[model samples]
Target: MKKNIESIFKAHLEPKEVYKGGKNIPPSDKKIYKLSSNENPLGASPKAVAAMKAALEHIDIYPDQTDMRLREALVKDFDGKLSAEQFLCGNSGSEIIDIILRAFINEGDEVIYSNPCFLPYSVFSRWYGAKTIDIPLLSPNYDLDVEGILNAITEHTKIIFLTSPNNPTGTYIPKSLLDDFLERVPKNILIVFDEVYRHFADAEDYVTALPYVLAGHNVLGLNSFSKTYGLAGQRIGYAYTTPTIANYIRLIQKPFLLPLTSIEAAIGALNDSEFIEKTVQTVLDGRKYLAQAFDNIGIKYWPSQANFFIIDPPLPEMEFTDRMMEEGIMVRPVSQFGAPGKVRITIGNQEANEACVKALLKIKS
Candidate 1:
């Protein structure tokens, strides 16, 4: 029985420490510029705030079980014939990923992703007893190695996770490149394009991968309101896929995991066009400022089309992240994302942009 307990619990444990932000420390009472996570430095939209406050009245009731209103709103907003059946509302982008893994992935199936992609792609793959196969992204730009990923597929391949303006790297796979790759990958494999950062991408040819879905391709486009919507605290995100896959995702998900306030907040967030436009402008402006500063400091970083930038400071990545924390600024070290010598910084407000640059300059790196 003791052996059986160990067996069940041990099968899905992460082999490495996943450094989620806000853990491993106490909450700082004074507001420190938090650029570690790619959150909108501007707080959530007023529209979302009002909705959440209104939802406070309904706390006694068990909230909407299926979040039908939110799903219906999404159907109309996408402008396509996106049925409510094609939508799966999860607690966060993370939960949506978890559901996808559970809904798919037979034992020993292969999950392919780029090295330096989002850590959860590997984490949750292991959680479901699926083998993880990581391929390295192209050098300097960190674009997806489309040819390499296409070649890596095997009969056992069950999933491929791609992040546009990828986390940590903040680089996107070109639409044409991805369109070609989608046409090549086997239909049996479910490919997920995690476009959580989609809102920040200013690239003209950026593909949402929705066309593939509309054409009945086996694809799942993952998105979350956490970034551009400034609703990270609300834990609201959604997945759009084929009706079959979406229904299967709904079946394994726990009942009412997404609360009333989160659902209401997400729905309200979608309507605030001005806030989103301003958020995009702020991040783009900050990106320009930070990129210029990074060049001046002789620190290596990439100019991004997304809301964050990746930098290789002159010192060890871990030491750089730690030193900045002491100076009341925190940046994420990309070592966890398989980029050992780099750091990923969110494009914060102007003040944070200045402070981060100053902190970087003060350090030896």
Candidate 2:
């Protein structure tokens, strides 16, 4: 008989709810507005839709092994400081996280990240048998604590994860603070910046770390087309880093990493600059409108730099979710992000935002 290998299996395989992409409740005939997931409320770029329709005719043919066109487009987007050789595409930002972890993390190594951050940081770290050093975000604003993170570092620390316009909280680390923090980190330790919501951030101090990558730092910027391009269903994301690191990640990636349709859709989305600009403007305007509505309704919410923000409702979270569903809206209860008594609300189209505000006022009253 074959010997049992269950004893050697990795521990703590309990699933963690990572991304809040709207719950899969029964398909009711009623129209349901999804304000749960941070998807683009404008729907996908029309160009992407058209490209996908064209790509349907070529599904039988295998995709190109190297995503040359997509990589070149991404490099051009960066304005020539970055080369096509210094990037890799993934099925999603989550897969990019896994690729980096697999490439660098070893047994008993330590990885540092903030609490209530992208949950995949902890899940994937534990999966690889690496110790997770989760530092709490500074109180009130949920800002990234550079001092706390620095204090948590040890000789065994292999990676540090930071997310700007962080999930659930919709907070970000200021560029000045980040510049100082980057200088203090050990040269050997890898710094991974997940800027999945970069396009939505309009705060004065918010900035991208691509310059650091250009200056030859051990930092990688992981981003997704899901939010900016409304292609969450397409599951396409990319990472920008040094060519050496990019080559290492590429070595461990799947043979046919991204589907042909997703590739075409991303290319199309990139071409539609007008659509992307309109989507960003809509989110910005809607954010201001919702903030005003929340103020008038007496609901407490975080000042957001991303397309979502955390709200503390008077009613219990599940009750709030149920009530919103009755009002034809779906919002995510985010006790999962360690913020009990609060929920994450994705900024949606003007109509959806107005509907959510109206529902909240009713619940509160």
- For TM-score, the strongest prediction is 2
Model 2 lDDT, residue 110, Cα: 99
Off by over 4 Å in 1: 1-4, 7-19, 22-31
Q: Rate the local accuracy (lDDT) of all candidates.
A: 0.85, 0.88
TM-scores, each model vs. reference = 0.93, 0.96
TM-score of 2: 0.96
lDDT of 2 by residue, 1-365 (tens): 67678766666544655544457545889877898889998999999999999999999999877787899988778878899989889988988898899999888999998877777888788888898898988888888888999998999999999999899899888989999999999999999999999998988889886988988899999999999899999999899998888888888888777889999999999989999999999999999999999999898999988998898877899998889999888989877776777888999999889888888888889
Residues 247-318 of candidate 1 have per-residue lDDT tens digits of 877888787778999988998988888898899899888888888888888888876878888888777888
lDDT of 1 at 152: 86
Cα RMSD, each candidate: 2.2, 1.7
Where is model 2 more than 4 Å wrong at Cα?
A: 1-5, 11-21
- Which residue pairs collide, candidate 2? none
